[model samples]
Target chain A: MRLELQGVSHRYGDERAVEEVSLGVEAGELVGLLGPSGCGKTTLVQAIAGHVRPTAGRVLLRGEDVTDDPPETRSVGVVFQRSTLFPHMTVRENVAYGLTRQGTDRITACLDLVALDEQRAAYPAELSGGQRRRAELARALAPRPDILLLDEPLSALDRTLRDRLRDEIARIQRETGVTTLFVTHDQTDAMALADRLVILEAGRIAGVDRPRELYHSPPTRFVASFLGRSNSLTATVVGVDPPAVALGDTRVTTPELSGTEDLEPGATVTCHVRPEHIVLSNTGGATPADTGFPDSLRNAEEKLLTLAGEVTRVTDVGHHYDVTVQSETGTALLVETATAPPPPGASVTLGVARDSLTVFD
Target chain B: MNWTRDSRSGYSLERLLPVLLGGLVLVYFAVPFLAFFTRTGVDGVVSGLSTPEARRAIRNSLLTAPVSTAVATLLGVPLGYLLARSSFRGKRLVEAVVVLPLVVPPLVGGTMILTAVGRFTPVGSAAYSVGVPLTDSLVGVVLAQTFVAAPFVIVTARAGFGAVDERLEQASRSLGHGPLATFWHVSLPLAGRAILAGVVLTFARAIGEFGATRIVAYTPQTAPTRIGVEYRRAGIDAVVPLALALLVVTLVVLMTVLRLGQTPGVDPP
Candidate 1:
């Protein structure tokens, strides 16, 4: 492990900010700490940076116990949420600040790595917002620290600039191969940049996994809802052999049903599925025949839970439309599709693959 | 100063009130300086400066003020920084003590200093034994000026250090610079302009310090003390030129300090 936080807990007087968060980041791997604001994400970053000593627990850097070390003694480079570039210093000077030897060579290389060599002579105030972030990145990287901690590096920026800088940071992290711990509230940034994601809620680790796995098979409901758009429907178990659950009058069963080992028949549970995983087929307006089931729904040979519903709302969200389908039993399910959505009040069928439903009690 | 009215009426009291209220105080300050300048021309200033008494006073003021300012900068700046950045058991008490000199009447402050270091006191006797008398000497003048002026540096430097972002210090530390280095490289530079402003104000205060200096040291006359003595003996005509010389010197130094404060390289754009 390049960095390990062993049961790190921090308290600000009476209020507990972080409570026993233990995790490890592998060498050369970029691990993201994903959480909502005030979930102790920044506190954890501060702990690793040695700005805050945890009320309890140890911080290990390359297997060395650095719990009592001050920030200057620890070889940790940090980029705060806001630009911390020294206002009085030019980009080159700021980058050369931490080096004791070969200052100019390291400064030039780091500035070039961030593509900020052209603005090396400019003061922090002279650069644009993106350029300031880039300059800060160069300054942090110039020291060549063992571990890099980025605390919401791409926040408070416009969408285009944020995405561009996000990609730039990912590229630099890869190029340097520095063990990095990225902290962000934005799931998109975390999912796009991290090798593994540690999801925090209320200062506790809710789940830790690869981004895709965590999003699809979240260990907790907080992870499921917070990671992406999810539709949660209450269902009851009808059988255990094939792991069947009933959505009102409709029975759906699949061998891939999870969280069903301790569940008995007639047990109430909440099933969650991502909006994009549910396929919607329009059954109204100029159908060749009204057989009460669309051909697209009938032909699905996969274990599917089919629900007959009417389109209650449709929102065009740039690349995709979110069609909200209200079933006959009044269960609302959101389906995301790139195809043209049926108008509101039109009849539709929601086809949900059985494996996509993540049930929780 | 009349211009075309846009949103305002020509006779509106709202627009005129500020000028009227501010102009009253402005006239109060301007009338004295104006009368003195109109009464004494350049010839008078030259003749006054040529006098041995005026030259000695000028030399004395020039020598003591800078030393006092330096003393204030050296001692008060660290105290100011400590007040700004740290918290201790008696922080509030320390702040109050720092401000005590500023609020106390100069004569009372001089009397307070005498109580601690009078000739009969142990501190004064020790200094006297060492061939450095604490009162009735140039050292006394410096002590009086520093006692009166040091608070300005302490107050302004505190405010300057307060305005500096703590995150910048933290950033420097994380960049592999220790706390002392961070203070030298980041906090000191960031707060430089404010501390400089405080130093300038301290010098101005020190040069003009009279009441305390008069009580502490009467032998070596500063410009203000000499002006007071000369005025009593020879009336307004004799002192006008002296006062004008002092005014011109103070104004020149003030202007130079202000100019230095705004230097392009030192100050952030």
Candidate 2:
């Protein structure tokens, strides 16, 4: 079923929790609402589930207006962060609870769907964290809701279990073709599980796009920083071409920015460069002077703008070395390096390719 | 550091204090009842039991107490649920009013009821028209007992309902159960223990009620009233056996009810 929210707003006294937010979820599509704590992601989901009546706006379920309907009449299934299985009931009983309420047969089939048929006789206390989460899922799915709402469903599990169940939940969503809305604070989860991601910030939609597009070309600095680690540099735009931007002694070009026509001659802009895009040079052969890059350095200088500093720390973190470089400008930059990492107090020049730098106006 | 010996000593002392205090209090209360039983003996107790007045009092106590408890449970449980779950203007005031009976002197409560249900009032006149007299009747005793005891049930049941997770109820609602079904299936079962505890407490309170019964309906002569009458007419010696019998019966019932409360899964037993 397609779920559409139109101008949904909510308030707790003077503080607005959600404000004029509107979004849609297509049938068989899993859309994730990603935001930080107190960002109203959960509030929006609650509104959709009819738990919270929106102060304004309407909720549409497959073209039917269910704005004023009570939660029990909405027929939407929800799996909460805390596994809300009835504590006194066994796993089987908890899973069958919704089904029995609907007077449906084949309760065992629902248990089998979440792979909890064996643990059905076990109480919630006896079940492992992942097992309990699975049981909660079974309970939610047993009713065959038109829309499934998951509010940080995998957050309570440990890392390994969270990763396992996240994949399991995605798989289940695909198999059942349930129109699903998942809310989570983890960006990795949103990117991995959601076909489309809606990034919310301060009770409003910051951006909404496909996962790949959102990661590759984030619309705002907030989206860019929230999605992954990016080195931000403040500079004034000196010149602009279709695909190339010239900033105070530095110019970077990217094909993704080729169609931009709004760049002016002199304007303050923020530059975003992923840590992986910066190439560390021992011989300084790939410096801006030699490679036609707009900016160049005389040596590893001790200034903030200069990507030149002594390595204060070097710790190998399995896949990458977490390198902390301190400059004379009193600014420190945390860089992730996968290649040869310098030992502590070692000097190295950092080279950033032009195409790898993203300039945001 | 000799930690093991110190720990053992501390644990033993912690265990001993409550046991010693509890045993002392038990003997203090049990001695008089025991004295009454022994002085009357099995033959005297049997002879006391054969009295028509004793039989009527026993029937009155049995008949009135359970009926009062039932009335309290029927009215109090739903009121408790509402108090716990809903938010409204003057909710705290409402709660205070419900529990007013608990703090009001039992005689004062009986007087309040008498004024409200006596022949001078609308309720009393309606009851008189229907040939139902609440004053000096068994029904009056039951009503007085219920008034004094209902607050116990309401308070316990409110706590029970409050202990239930609202999320679970919402989850049930989302699963297609209506409001009433959700209450029946999720809310009540989860709060069952608290409700059972409330029932036992209300029953005990109603059975032991003396002041209200005395003021409202002294004619039917429930056990407590009868014991009071015997004490007045023939001194403590004359009423000791009946008092002892009532005390023994109430203690057994209370212990059984408490055991039921402590039972796992089903709320006591």
Task: Return the top candidate by lDDT.
Answer: 1
lDDT of 2 at A176: 85
Error of 2 at B108 (Å): 1.0
Pull out the clashing pairs in model 2.
B260-B268, B260-B269, B261-B268, B262-B268, B263-B268
- Among the numbered candidates, top DockQ falls to 2
Best by TM-score: 1
Query: Which residue runs does candidate 1 get wrong by more than 4 Å?
Result: A237-243, A254-267, A284-303, A306-310, A326-332, B1-24, B261-269
Interface root mean square deviation of every model, in Å?
A: 2.0, 2.3
DockQ of each: 0.55, 0.59
Give one digit per residue, the lDDT tens place, for model 2 in B88-168.
Answer: 999989999998998899999999998989766898778878988887888999989999999999999999999998888
Query: Could you give the CAPRI-style class of model 2?
Result: medium
**Clash count, one per candidate:** 0, 5
Q: What lDDT score is found at residue B74 in candidate 1?
A: 96
> lDDT per residue, candidate 1, A57-176, as tens digits?
999999999999999989999999998888888888889997878567788999999998998888888899999888888888888899999999888789999999999998999899
lDDT of 2 at B250: 77
> Could you give candidate 1's per-residue lDDT for residues B141-244 as a string of tens digits?
99999999999999989998999888899999999999889988888877888898899899988998888888888869998889889888988777887677
